[model samples]
Target: MPLRSTRVAIGALAAAAMLATAVPASADDGGRQRHVNHVLLLSVDGLHQQDLAWWISHHPGSALARLADNGIDYSNAKTTFPSDSFPGMVAQVTGGSPKTTGIYYDDSYNRALLPAGTTNCATAKPGTEVTYFEQLDKNLNSIDAGQGLTGLPGSILSMTGSPEQVIDSAQLPVDPKTCQPLYPHQYLKVNTVFEVARAHNLVTAWSDKHPAYDLLQGPSGNGIQDLFTPEINSRADAAGDDWTQANSLTQQYDGYKAQAVLNQIDGYDHSRSVKLGTPAIFGMNFQSVSTGQKLPTSDGQPGGYLADGVTPGPVLADALSFVDQQIGRFIAELKKHGLWDDTDIIVSAKHGQSPTVPAQLTRIPDGPIIDALNKAWNNAGHSGTLVSFSIDDDGMLMWLSDRSPTATGFAKSFLAGYSGNGNDINGKPKPFISAGLATIRAGAQAAAMIGVPVTDSRVPDLIGIAQKGVVYTAGTSKIAEHGGDADTDRDVPILISGTGFNRSRTVDQPVATTQIAPTILHLLGLDPNELQAVRTEHTLVLPTVG
Candidate 1:
């Protein structure tokens, strides 16, 4: 079955062209000619380089195959460590790792901030978990995030606002210095490609699963002029299925965002009601692929592979096909609107799912690990629990109640000796943690790995990288997860198609997704140094791109 079409009626091409904003020449352009007037950046979250190669080879003449045929495919591209959606996406726009971005994960700890709803930031207890996910939504269960005039999901297609307008301030982390809610943008320590585009008088736009993606607006908080976010976590229908629950439902949810991109291509706002013209930089992320890699179908067909783990299974194959069809639609629309020649399509993933090989899989609950750590702390005569917060998947990241060397060392020692007593995905007696505890990095070492200092408030006190195939999940819903340094989580696909790309070329050199930010600026005739993170990290543009 094909994805449900949510095409929005757009105005005439001539009218949209008239409304199109011109990209002004920047002094920082340095006489570099712009090869593409518009750049469409799409993150097909959970797409691995291996998966891209397999898809193109198996499905010749498909959208992905055609893109690769005309673009430079970076076969060895990797995302950042602690490879969660937030940090991985941020790395693409900021050209920096968690160190410079100060973003470890969506739900991370900030020692300098107060808990949400703390009115008196100056007097409230410091150190709180900063959650930038659907929890911050006015109503996560509603498709419009409960911010639209009407309750129906369709009403948001013409809505003119963003999550920033509906986010409850009381739910955001309070900055002690400002005594105000620290929005996602404010939490970012550096500028983004969108900010650079905005500074150059170029219009920018984007769409994602949740409003918290407003972080893409960069530090200025207004980099994206046409930000459209319909919550993916919102209930899909009367059946109560959500985007994450089933692959089919995820495709339906992704269709809404894909239609918005089509509207942008037709020179209209995401709403398709306003003729704002095609943005200089615009695109939306696709959740279907990610969902397929993680969740089973409604029919109980599991996600991932069939033993080998390289070849996609039935549920995943359908997801790959759905995304390909969407991309085909995007290309057709761009040509219809005469924007193909002036446009470039950049496709990559924020992060990839783990334990592709079924034999390597082990599903262990995290409750035991937390309980063990806390118990160890108490046994050592600690007055309070040593663990302040933790987010575990294929790996574990923990914030400590006390970050002192002694406290950090004690916790690390305890975890190093701790053994997994959980079962595998099939309920077999397998170590949940396996031998992964040996790779734990504590305190200063953990921060140093990401190029941050020990004093960095957002740095986790301990990072435990799981052994291959060890997923810290007890539920049967998902076979895999991200947010780890495993190859399946960090190794992702990256390809740039359209004008000026080396046709049918492949680059196998090890490269990081952080390079995508500088490349975006470079492609648009803007200095890469314009992005603060690019300059700070000395990030370079991708190879073989002129």
Candidate 2:
């Protein structure tokens, strides 16, 4: 592994303002060091090392092949623990862990949140979880308000789905016990690289699945210059584009947003008229791979049967091809614009999907577990806050009712007795949770298995990892899931290419995505330590660069 001598060219936030006056590309220390001014960060929701291998073994002439040949490849790159999308993405940008970012998953129970939004909290629906996948604010406020580039190449149109979860710290119904504001972003204890870049007046732009991703904005303002997202949950189609085509609607959504990156590369944004020129940092996440992970063969060629030893079916192949083609286009556009040399492109994924082997699919329903917990909470006669549940692929996140210790104890006991089978010790297989009560434990033991801290605020009071070869689902979604410590869930493809480095190199040393934030800053000749989270975490920048 090689190390680059990194220094903070901008001493302080104030220095950032002073230097902000310069154009997109600037020199470091009176031109003593060459700098890569532009950085395009692209994330595939569920890209895995295996997927890349499949592409190489299948499509020999893929853009992926070109990238691997041109830049440094981290053959062993892992995402943050829990491996959920929210935490995975944050790991790259915040250079921190779930504990540092306080983002465990997109869907996790936060009793700290105002139990309910504008709606009421009821037993049937535990309102404790602050779903980061929000499309609209609790007030139904549109997410399009000034979220995109002010001036546009085209108007940043209003998006469908929920809007940015508008937060007026003053308005949130504070938790009576904690009396703490329940805003999601507020929970992110540390800042992201996005904010650090902005501190020096660097322009950054990003497009994700939803406005709720405003979390990337970090606590401090100045994260993105232009942020564009179409409500991911919406079924609406872009004009003249039929989502019903071979392209999965989800793939279509991802492709649509990827086009935004194309526009940004071309010196503008979805705000067609606003001349963004080229942002210092910009990129978008692609969901095509994720969509392919779950697409069943019944769905057709675009539908894939991707599992261990399984060459991608037609659908999976199509998905990979689509992504490869897009990457080629991105590279070509950068070259055409002549910004290719000044820009560094990092193609990676937030996390990997699980159970690549179809035989490993184990669908364990949550009905029994939920029923037992609810009943126990009722028996405890405590605050009676119903426990909230989040099933992350194979891992389970259970936020026990915010009641007395009695309620939690009872819930735990019931879980302990559960066996997905009838009895814990040796009972008959439970009906719904056939593998239920498989392994019920918490604290460090549970966290150790999944690689998350039991003490993490975002961690659930009770985490359930189904029995080996078991998953928590009823065969509705994809075959393999993520969010657990499964190798299939953690190993992701990491490629650092484009203008800065020469000749491709492969580093087998394991690197965490946490290093990417600092790596970006380091490439641009900024002090990697300026990113407090990475600095505080003692994260190192990636090895070898321009």
Candidate 3:
């Protein structure tokens, strides 16, 4: 079935054009004359580069296939480690790793955070660190907090989402005991592409799953000119419901946000706040692909699962087809609005799901891991001090509450040679925190397994990486998942195409999502160095220009 479409009744093109805000140009920086005026970055969450390749090949001559014909495909591109959505998106905009960005997952232990508002961390004690990214706002009903469908966008095609709406209900980690709620815009430690564009007077806009993604605003002053988020995580009670189911609502909401970008191309935001005239950088993330990749259909259908060497099932095919159709619609709209020639449409994923092979999927409950952790603490002689921790991405992004060096030292020593006492659900007895002395940082042992230095407070201490394909999942429904050290978990397809992107043909050199921000800046004739994180970390940009 095709994705349902509901186009907003936009005012005449003339009115939109009248609202067009000119993108002020910087004096020619004496480099290649850049003509790329707009960027449409579509992140099809949970899409693997291989999956995209499969879909395009199957459809033969589809919109995505055409995009590949004219673009450079980074076959070896990888998402930053801790491949959770939080770090994944941050890497794209910040040009930095968790080491610098300080985000590990949607919910991770943070030594710096404190509770905000009435949402208390029941697990957090007076002297302990903070837990961040708890979506505490989901506890409300439509009428509970004056939030109801009445306030939702009348139509996705008509208005850009307010970044505020997305974060209003999220229970964010705050300063310890300060009750200062952590706002998305204020959480970023690095400047984002949106911020840099705003600094350069280039109108910018974006569409994401939730407002908390406003964290993309980074340190820039209201960097995003038009921010629209559908709050995919929200659910309203029956009294608050307008007949739309939450899942279907999220898909529809995603479409509307994507349409917001289409509206920008038409020279205005949905609300006609002003003539946006196509921001230099704008794009939307499609959750349908991600949702379909992992979930069963409402009527219970075989969803998109890639069994070793097998393509997505019928249900998944629909999702991919919908995504392709949306891209086609976007491209058509861009052409209709005369924005195609100078635009670049880049497609990538926030993270790839796991069990690329169906049989490799496992359902080892988190109990074994948690039990083993406490056991390790007991063995370390800290039996009385039960420290808090979070399984930030299946051990790949583990975080402990105790930020002290003593805790760090204990974690390293314990996990360096941890051997679970038949507690693993694998029945045959799975090992704990695998590490090899031959690996780098032999001094830190288990700490070196994750490659983060012990002094990095924002990172996890005790590393718990399961063997490739052995997922430690607490849920029974999700068989294939990501967020680990598995090779398939980290690798994602990255295709770069645009009038301004002066590169063609694939490059095998190892590259990461971190290069995206600086590359976007360079494409716009802006100084890539303006992204401080990239400069400080000596990150490399993809070879894009002449």
Candidate 4:
């Protein structure tokens, strides 16, 4: 669909909703009065809390430090489960967990949706119903018609890359019958925050690394398929330049997205001031260090570049510096446009990455575990590996088929015999399964044997911990990976700043990525209790509104 017509239609729909209710604002309404006029949501992928602290303490005058000094810092922010891009991003936006949002990982198991006997990552889809920003738009529209005020903008801009790439990778081989993308946005069962914003006649914009902008263009019958505005921008492509240098590439992409946002803020019709609002919300996803997979850099490796064994190479350090500069520029532009004082800026990350582990270090052999398990299951007349297996950060989760009664039991028994025990890598005492079990009690015992923390809902049903220098692989170049039961994969930084925020206050309370959406909503004077995505008990205290 043409991007122009898409925007026009969205604008017209919002205008019509506004005109339909030419009523005066009321004070006694159940909905809280909108206190926040502008919100800027920024997501920096692969950012750890230590990285933030290091930037603040070591790199004075850095953009991050400025924000930290002026904002409230939540030191214990974390991603809920399978700490990968898709799940982490969904958790951040939806304010929900995998169990509720249904976005468990970059690729998740969906047996009923796909053909039987599928085990590959390329064949997965949303196993349950989910919802995203599109739904949020619809709700916002409902609010506009019901209330006198203009609704919020439900637009989303992301640089995380294409949802299509993620969906395609999750599925097995494409089914010859359907001949369509296996995992589409239609699979999401709930509404996203952006959807709510747009329904209220607010302008939304996004800039990111992926084609996410294009995928989520408009509401139903509006424009883009994903219910986002404009769909996407082509600025992420670097002409004749490799994206491996973290500093160089991050600076370029961040500057590009930041400029796009500034453009909208500049063009906004602020003359009407209180009459017609400008772009209400803007978000950007900066992806550069992730490209480090193709670059020759290490987290703590020596011999490249270092001071006192801390190898802060040009690749890593430069990228950090570049992103910091872009952030400073973004803030400057906001101030130039006279929106800095009123706008609330949030800086956070989707997830953090651990250093790469070379394949030669461990020398583990390629095993026939999948084939053996499949053959064993078929021979047992149990419909062939009913539980699809995939390796996650720290362990392997076996997604069982709803139809298979003994699938869980079969998985428990099959995983019991693996040689690598959980505690071997970390010196922490953890159980190692030597063979499979026949009962649920035995399954529990098996899990305990492997040192897998049972309370973390995000942990895979079956767990495996790689030795310190060892990383499991499908023989690909993605040497550095996450999704493990390790500290490096779980820790992320959350920085909240701007407009009624208490500056320089550090809170050490444990907060997960899932808490962010609700926090933002609450800060904006929206009742987060209305959204099913928010946990009932998780509430963020914001600066009081008059």
Identify the candidate with maximal lDDT.
Answer: 1
Model 1, 68-166: lDDT tens digits are 988889898888887888888888888887777887777777888998888876579888878788878888787787675574766768655466986
Model 3, clash count?
8
Error of 1 at 66 (Å): 0.8
Q: Please write out the lDDT profile of model 2 over residues 1-546, one tens digit for every residue.
A: 000001111110000000000001111222225578898898987788777877876777788887777788878888876777778888888888765566777655554455444343322232354545542333322223324433221333433212233433343434544555445455577887778778888777888866667778777644776777655543233343222223466565666677778888888754445776787878988877776765444244634453443567677677788888888888899999998889888989987775566555555545545665566566767444356544435665565545345444566577666654331111224343423434555545444544455554455665555454444553344355666666767789778886445577877777788888878888777888887776667777776654
Global lDDT of each model? 0.77, 0.61, 0.59, 0.45
Candidate 4 per-residue C-alpha lDDT over 445-528 given as tens digits, one digit per residue, 9 for 90 to 100:
333432333332222344344334333332223334454334455577888777455457787766677666665666565655
Candidate 3 residues lying further than 4 Å off, grouped into runs, are 1-32, 117-160, 165-170, 176-179, 236-250, 271-274, 296-298, 375-385, 401-453, 500-504
Between the candidate structures 2 and 4, which one is better when assessed by TM-score? 2
The TM-score that candidate 4 achieves is: 0.64
Judge candidate 3 against the unseen true structure and give its global Cα lDDT, from 0 to 1: 0.59
Give the lowest summed-lDDT range of ten residues in model 2: 13-22
Which 10 successive residues of model 3 have the least lDDT summed?
12-21
Q: Order of candidates by lDDT, top first?
A: 1, 2, 3, 4
Report the error of model 3 at residue 72, Å: 1.4
Q: Which residue ranges in model 2 land beyond 4 Å of their true spot?
A: 1-34, 117-127, 135-183, 237-247, 297-299, 376-392, 402-413, 420-440, 444-457
| Candidate 1, residue 284: lDDT | 85
Between prediction 2 and prediction 3, which has the larger TM-score? 3
Between prediction 3 and prediction 4, the one with superior lDDT is: 3
Q: How close is candidate 2 to the true structure, as a TM-score?
A: 0.79
Residue-level lDDT of model 3, residues 302-327, one tens digit each, is: 65464553588666677778888888
